[model samples]
Target: MRQSVGATDAPEVRPCPECGTEVTVHPWYVTWCAACDWNVDPGAPDPERGRLAQVRRRLASRHGEQLAQEIEQGAGGGRGGPDRSTVLAFGLALLVHGVTVGLCFAAAVLIIGGWHTGIQPVLGVLLLVAVAVLLPRPGRAPSGPAVLYRADAPGLFGLIDEVGAAVGTTGVHAVVVDASVNAGVRTYGYRGRRVMFLGLGLWEILAPQERVALLGHELGHFANGDVRSSFLMHGALRSLAEWHAVLRTVNHDSIVDWFLNALTFLPRWTVYGLLHLLDGLTMRASQRAEYLADTGSARAGSSGAAVALLDRGLLVDGVEAHLRRESMAAARAGGGAGGREEREAAERELWERLAARIGSVPESEYERLRRVSARRGHSVDDTHPPTHLRRRCLASGDPQPALVVCDGPRAQVVAAELAPARALLARRVIRDHAG
Candidate 1:
């Protein structure tokens, strides 16, 4: 029988199949035969089903394995100049921008030269409006309802800065904390200052070192020069996607015309083709960037801690299920009346309860989830390699001591700084789920 969680600290004794050694595994979390390291990653390459998706998945798997092997074998990074992929991605993005500029110039001529002409001026104004709507604009820095400015969250900000410096980049200018089970960094505003987003669902469960690993992984994107995250490339991709979405929605019922349908086909398919090509060109670089980011994870938080952080991604389903149960049990109390006090109580207990639930997850559950992750090619999305592969990439590397540490005293300060955001998010979660 699989053991339930909340067990004693005693490690379970298991025999290694290969070495016949007594390998010890923990109750709450364990994987593989320690003596021989058997079953650490026993699965074959992840497989894909369906036609087109199958092809894409195979390509992704190939890139993931290739990149993981390269990093594992201590491959050094590229030379400072942009590689072929980067150059192509940039060139394609410029072409996209050039098309926009050409339209803008044409519109300007029509507007300016056709000043006295009636229909031409109207047409010019409409054309310019259409171009303006389609033109890509830089996204502003994100702000959460409960933002934690550096002044208010000095400990957290300081730790992030230290990680950034360790990873060789300027730290984030602002931090937005939300209730998502994810974290990431993005360039925001015209100057492209970095902004880090912290999601409490994941953050609340991480050990201090794992949290540092998360920070390092995110900032590593900047340090490693992720092709997808750049303003030009990202903007182009988003613009193309938006254009695809918009064009796909345009339809003709044809009271008089199938030609209207014919007219829309060329531009729509062109955008689709360009989007596919650009994405394909950047695929290898993006995958490589992720592996390199894992290196950042190791550099800041130690290889063991970085790998452990990846392991945590597998348990999010467990956490969310526990949350639904908690919400049903507590948020629905008082027979749908006196909700204000009930919500307050739920908010007060939110983090502690979540901590206990996650803490109680058994190692067997993690082992099962790992298998599920392997079977399903589970990830943040297709953009990320499977969690197991990421773990492999880190595990394959040389063990590194943490270059940036988050100690107990500093952790407390960081928690205190995030307290208000916690309360607001907790309240929102309870309110949203309450029946």
Candidate 2:
């Protein structure tokens, strides 16, 4: 998934509350002063942090308002604010680009008609070049990479179908298997068909019920219309980024370059400023959608399973990172004619080792995981809430025991069917990381 977050090239200036030193605020609610080493809210305070979080918190306190009503109805609030903000930002950006293009073309006509002098002609040419470079182009639909379909792996595809139907969506169009420790769903083609990417490593480790919760969380986004919202927001951000990239046509090289840089600096800075503002404004909706998805996961599987998945995520991330490093080393050391097969085998072995390591994790280790899970700071790139917050949210919901949503026999059969795709992608992962 192409995750979206607000960005700003220029640091926000503020004074430190603890020390009086001048501080710069970065995205994800970070306010820090280099001289005084003052950081804001590193303790993972209750109710979340960041400007958007504060806004959501205040909105939650009220009753009968649109957002408050959404929350009261358990319908997932926060979308309205972001939806309006995205449209406004996108419209303003298009307006700016349209005016720029119109002026440039009008100037070109004047110069071509011999109605403008030397400096005007030069200005017209420059404006035309700027328009050409800065204009946003349509994004291409991503090509299908390594994937599996119903014909390729009926059991795996059937399992996905069963889960999808259980979660209340029709079903995904296809599945892309990969070798990371994460999974996501994205839309492709004009019809907005869904393609889900599943990580072999994550699948190998999660229990059957955990898998359901994970899938429900991902697929539920489609059911809840998050995919549609994200698409537009991502497009707006990309267009702004293109404009900014076009304006930054100078390096600190020559006097002319410096002058050009100075000229376009404000425009580039404006794009950054707008991006940051959009990110802050949209964050609440994005994060709320995640919680709502978790709710769906809990409903589909069990609350215990959903919360356990979040708690186990810390361990999963650590184990996967370590095993990937080992796989990289093995691939590097065993280079030869049969290196490909060797690397694949090595990666499979490492994956098994990871699974075993996770199964045998000491009780003491969980305490450490708890500490790490509790240590929270806003991630500028991540739209999901912190895992601890997710766990708490699920816990507060209807109680249910942890149990497998899929039968033991079926889970095993699905696992067996996915072995080929898993091994193929695992090797690809090892090779990429080794390089």
Candidate 3:
């Protein structure tokens, strides 16, 4: 039977597949016969291999690859990429600064160049008007039903049950929607509460343990009330940043622009400097939250499995690249109205490009690059922490600091009761749908 490395330390005597020499199988080297370096197929039906295969299957099921595919098809077709939302955030910032600089420049011209005319004041007012137009207003608070959209209803239900059991709560409801690799917890409608959105892509690439880890993290957001706080903070920052950018831009080309430009050298440096600083702070906070979620996942289930899944996730191209590409694509499509569809498409493209670039390198080389990227301060206005940092932190396993059961007692009971039924189901599903 397949045995967990964590379950034992005693070396088990087994024949090496290659040399047939009696060799001791150590817990750490579960995937290969240490003496001969013979590869072990984890999915093999032999009892020991079957155990590893089951773990792999569990990881795949939790990750929801099938669901991710379905969502991609529904959201629009092809492997969904990032689109407008990413660009809009940048675009909005640009527009705000452009207007501000222009206004300031005009004011300076009037004061310094002695062009104090009625036209100047009118121009100033117009610049202010433009600033008002460019910045986004605060969004309405989320409320209403807790809906979760997904492609695999049964699988999702099982996951929800697992999460609920882990957290000591009744199961949450979910609904599947069309989108690749995106998920979020939202509060919407008139009575604002909690709802979850599961994207098809999220399930596509993650193993089961990673899926649980992700869910645990999201659920932690809900539990900690961080979601609302993030929304408010982001809205306020965007609004203030827009206002400042407008003021800065309106001053450009005017006498004020010359003074400020002389003082600052480059207007963009001044703006971007502040923006990057704020983005970094926010990213750091988000990273910490991610760690908490990882802790929660470990509490809910297998830590090693969760870590393995997260490592895999790090390999997937991130959402930012997808967003960038999507924006360019939508711009090309001539649907530049800044609607939801356009925004989602833009975000997808941005992430897709990043993923493509990263995927081009060999796996071993890629890991090295990722480590280097993490250490050299490579974060660029990202909301999430670098994946390498996340992996390292989770692997340390010291964050939780208390003796809490990784898997819930009730969950274990439920799994024990359902294992037989699930096994039968798995057999039939595999036989009928073997591809």
Q: In model 3, where do residues sit more than 4 Å from their true spots?
A: 1-158, 164-179, 225-231, 248-281, 318-380, 398-435
Q: Rank the candidates by lDDT, best first.
A: 1, 2, 3
Which model scores highest in TM-score?
1
What is the Cα-based TM-score of model 3?
0.42
**How close to the true structure is residue 122 of candidate 2, measured as C-alpha lDDT?**
72
lDDT of 1 by residue, 322-393 (tens): 567656655567366776676677778887778766876666557655665666663323567677878877
lDDT of 3 at 343: 42
> Model 1, residue 39: displacement in angstroms?
16
Q: Model 1's lDDT to the true fold?
A: 0.77
RMSD of each: 5.2, 11.9, 18.4
Off by over 4 Å in 2: 1-145, 227-229, 332-345, 400-404, 430-435
Candidate 1: residue 324 Cα off by (Å): 2.8
Tens-digit lDDT string for candidate 3 (335-390): 44554454443343332333444333334334443444343322333445455655
Better of 1 and 2 by TM-score: 1
